[model samples]
Target chain A: MPPPPLPIAPPDTDPPGIDQQTLLAALRARVARLEGAGREGHGAAPIPVCEGLGLSGGGLARAALHEILAAEPGCGAAFAAMLLGRAGGTVLWIGAGAEALTAWPPGLARFGLLPANLILLRAAQWSDALWAMEEALRCPAVAGVLLAPDWAGDPAAQALDLTASRRLQLAAEAGGGIGLLLRPDMAEPPPSVAASRWRIAAQNAAGAGQGIGDPCWRLELLRQRGGRPGGPWTVTWRAAAGQIDRESEALEAESA
Target chain B: MTAPRRYLALHLPAFATDRLRRAEPDLPQDVPLAIWASQGPRRLLSAVDLRAWAAGLRPGQALADAQAIAPDLLLRPADPEGDLRLLEGLALWARRYTPLAALDAPDGLLLDITGCDHLWGGEAALLAEAQERLWRAGFAVRGAVAGAAATAGALARAHGDGPVAPSGAEAEWVGPLSIAPALRLDPALLEQLGGLGLMTVADLLRLPRPGLARRFGVDLLDRLDALAGRRHAPLRPVLSPPDLGAARDLVEPIITRTAIDALLDRLLDQLCAKLRAAGRGARQVVLMAWRVDGAVQEVAIGTGTPLRAPAHLRHLFRDRLERLEPGLGFERMALEARVTEPMSGGLQSALAIGGRRDEAAAQLLAQLLDRLRQRVKVRRLAPRDGHWPERSVAALPLLAPMPEMPVGWVRPDAPVLLLRRPQPIEVVALLPDDPPALLRWRNRPHPVLRAEGPRRLEPEWWRGPGVARDYHQVALASGARLWLFRAGPPEAARWMLHGHLP
Candidate 1:
């Protein structure tokens, strides 16, 4: 499905810069390519793409992270390696309390990602959490961020607006770096100004003794500026080994 | 250093000493005596004048002038270091309220209690409780809550000159206030702002941004940005790192070691799960046993390393619980961990799997030493840290690990009577090299056995109260050995018993 066109201010044609349309186009292109390759069904249930490569496979979130890195490894190699290596960075992983921060490292590490690129600032209170988040956003050299929404719900509207603005500011400052806002379990996807949004969850696997490939998750490409929302795709991850694959369920397709 | 966004400046009267002096001769609380310290003959550096200050006399006046005004002015020298230490201790006590508390400029503190207000009911309640505690400690305090450091400082000094600004309202609060000289703003910038008819912060704030940026340097703009919340500023807190705490509640209270073992199993399981979830593990576990007889017994067991495993942790607690004197039937038992470290999942097993079996076994054997330490109440269980024999492996209290080298040692191979501390021994000998031909200990002469040295230890030249000694590892004829040393450089020496072998 095509994304709703963002209401942008009158055009300032000062060469090319990030705008809603450009983002939408990128999203659309990505969706079309996934559809064109006959990989849409397989995406919802990611299958091992190792027919020839003999590669290991796993779940979707890990797949996306790996795919993102495989596509542009050098872009975040230093940061990615640092986070995966368990070195520390200035990335503020926000959540309700100790539980949220505690659940992060292994989840990321399951995808062969290290939090070495993160400085764990556990914000027991919402106000300090905001302060920490704002501080992390402003700091340069902070590669990518993982944000877990406050359990108390959305922050003050002004603070949220400021944070959204900070996302753009951080992107501009870091060239190609991005921040991930992990929303709590949502009925419908929450509105965000993120470059993209992917819904991740654990899924059961078919094979025995495979340790259920990195907890398969369904990824719904909800928002992209220049692109369409790619149909939900299933991705499998083998986290420890950092392998990801796509699987297609024919029975589910027929039922749908 | 990370500067704070808000500061709560506190001012205490200099009457600390006068109160002490007034109490010397059973000083009456109502008499109003002032205490001031002085280096100069007549000048008073810091004063605690109950009568004069109460009568509107501020600190820093000459003693004679104060005496003229109030004849009973008590003078004493101020120990700034002591006052600072007291404030630091208070800051530690304040951490129960919020973790983001920092030291404010001398005699003040800034707590970044953004959302921690509810812990003590509300901010007002918290402040009231804090004030009550301090008042009991005999301090006169005036407090004001403001959003910005500048506003808080100004208003506190002015004794609640303005209302408390809600969070994010610092810009408005500070705008109406004057920028005092103590705020440390550049004089030139102040003059320039003053020239533009901007005596108050509001005047300076109302000017166009471009003109303000052009006139004043980036510092003013930065300050404005921080004040207006355009950019967030974080406070670098001086409080201790957050604790990793875990507790357990038993369904049924049981007192026996087996029952305690089961309870520990459940608690360790939950605690380790929490620690793993947080990417950390525990270094200390405190077990509290509530007895049916209205007495609560607590046994704290500290691990040499952070252990998150249920089984390994249970074992550590098992060793500690064996010695507890359970006076009554237990009603409830709880196990909690106090300290923790980053979760290193595979490091513990790496030794077992890496084929370094002997080294790992040695490490386990070393752990036996810790068990011995617990049983014997030896705080320090490590081999001596220095090359000096007498100072090596000096036993300390089981709870207090020594941070410095001790002054005595016992040779591992030497057969000697061990003592906790060195004591003077009387000996009669012809020369330093010769064995103590005769030695009088407890007024008895012991025949010479084999003796080691006048291994001379020179007096520490750089420090005072120097004691020189000539140490010898001596074995008595009756097979009772002694670690003896002669004091007083090589020339003038007297023997003493330093330590004995186990």
Candidate 2:
């Protein structure tokens, strides 16, 4: 919650003679205080702050990097759309290289995101993709950025090191847009400055052994800044609504 | 009233040789190089370098004779067309000094620098600047400014180099110059004048006009009057292209990144202020850094929205700064807004609850698009004036709104992600008319928890592929509700998955 301790390396000072960072920090603190007082300044940030855990009542902080680890092929994208969709802003989906399909993958509205509002950007190169994603996050109009770079072929570019995440975080903060990085891995993710990290896997819903029931997935909260960090919870991935539902009668959540 | 016109004649001596030397710096300097032209029965040298002239090989010499004098003489065929094009290009660039520039053909540019000279700190400074630029551009030039185009051209060709003849000085300006170029006479007339031993322009002025006209025709007297400021013949200057941007030239070339950044800040302030004054906004900014070595480094930045604020423009330029390929050191910098839009409603609106949110979303998306161009292709869906399920609506680009649709029309509830091609699935039904009880897809069975649809749609002959389909919205045991359709007759019906209902 206190930000996993600042990195070992001290914050690098700003360029010589232009000490804007100090002023910037002071302004940020003042803004936070003003927001705390329930008074928004002119041109309020596009992305609203999150209440907690999921993307409801402000699902994710504006311009924050959120990594979703997916064990299954399509679950991470589906989950990302589900969250950003509910946040109700323009959505940008960036897929780097030919690894991504041409068409928009299914299940955007199932989580409450409008399919029409989704803007799909196909990047020819990984660097272009990363740059565009960061640029999008820095724009006030964009609500979310979903970056899916080519991880298998170009790990050097795909690796979301802490520094890269920090850069994305800075861009996101500038425009008050949310950033979501979807990677395919069930294990602990590499070090990153993302505010929230999740792991997801598609699983059989109860009694969905032969016949498909409500879509169920193993949803794990690997790291959340202010949330239950430990989780292997089974939640029904409502295919149509694009939300994680855990109801007693319809959902029946189970411990993974 | 029309702006008063003053002419500056730019004489590019050795234009071909100088241009070729600049293009091929590795050329042998010691060799006598000449641009040759075929004149009827023999190949004659049209232009020769100093080395060739020093070897007693003058222009118009037979190519064989020149080669005999300097056995290793380098003779390149002259390219008159390319030379003319280069002259025209320089005329265009002269706009940096004045708005009116004209080509004198062969190897000269004439500029009307009547009022613009003050901007460069006076006439001398302006002439000095033009001369310095041409020298830097690898041309050996003779420039002279005068009230008359003919006087300026004569002075530039004969006696003056970077000389300025003030107003009403055209007659005196040509007095001390040579007769050959001052008269601009044909070779035959010049030879006739030489027979009389009249070589100086003053000698030509001393001759009676009636005698000169009887000997040299009316053109000779007419040209002499134009050169002496007795008559005014307007120069047909090439249309001056508009320069709607600002540029800054440094006293000393700069190579350091910090200096460039500081320079950029000043330039952005200037450019954005200009845009703001015009009630216009710029979408793209092109930064060109003219290096000391005569090279130009250019970088262009595009913004998602019309930008009038210097800070945002600076931010956009920051990302593209890496693209500037500065060679040596930069001596001049220019900022131009290549694309512009009228600033709409002052760039900001009252922060309405929904409007702010939409603006923010649009801004973010636009920013992303600006960085990664051609990446996002939004297929916009809009209601069309049709009745068929597929034809009733149209998918277009987001920028184009759909036309009016039929009244009381509403888009039916459908899956957000629809399969463009319906995938086949095995279905089991209790009765031919009843909804499917179960279906199998991807080799997995889906038990029908509920069946809701049989919304029958008939084929429309007006639309092609006019096949009928019995559409159904079925709830599966997997909790995934799908949009399905049956094609062909009931006796041999086939079911396919069309989409999923959210």
The most accurate candidate by lDDT is: 2
* Candidate with best DockQ: 2
Q: Write the per-residue lDDT of candidate 1 for residues A176-230, one digit (tens) a residue.
A: 2234444434554435444444444333344434211223334345544334445
| Model 2 agreement with the true structure over A29-105: per-residue lDDT tens digits | 67545433212222344343222235322345555688888764355656676767665666777776663232233
Scored against the native two-chain complex, candidate 1 gets a DockQ of: 0.00
Candidate 1 residue lDDT tens string, B1-502: 5433434434443425523542365666556565566655666635555565686555667667777876655455566676666566555445544556666545665666556666667766666666565555566654556566545544454444324556567667667666542233676777767776777666766878887788777778776665544565556566444455444434455767777777767777777788888877676766756554334556776655456767666655665786566665565565656677775762442222112345443234223223333332212223354333343334433223223323333222222112335677888788765557677765788775555665666654554566766667554444334557777646667677764321
Docking class of 1: incorrect
The weakest ten consecutive residues by lDDT in model 1 chain B span B409-418
- What TM-score do all the candidates reach, one by one? 0.38, 0.60
Measured with DockQ on alpha carbons, how good is candidate 2? 0.14
Off by over 4 Å in 1: A1-256, B1-35, B43-56, B63-90, B118-141, B146-151, B159-162, B166-172, B175-238, B245-338, B342-413, B416-441, B449-502
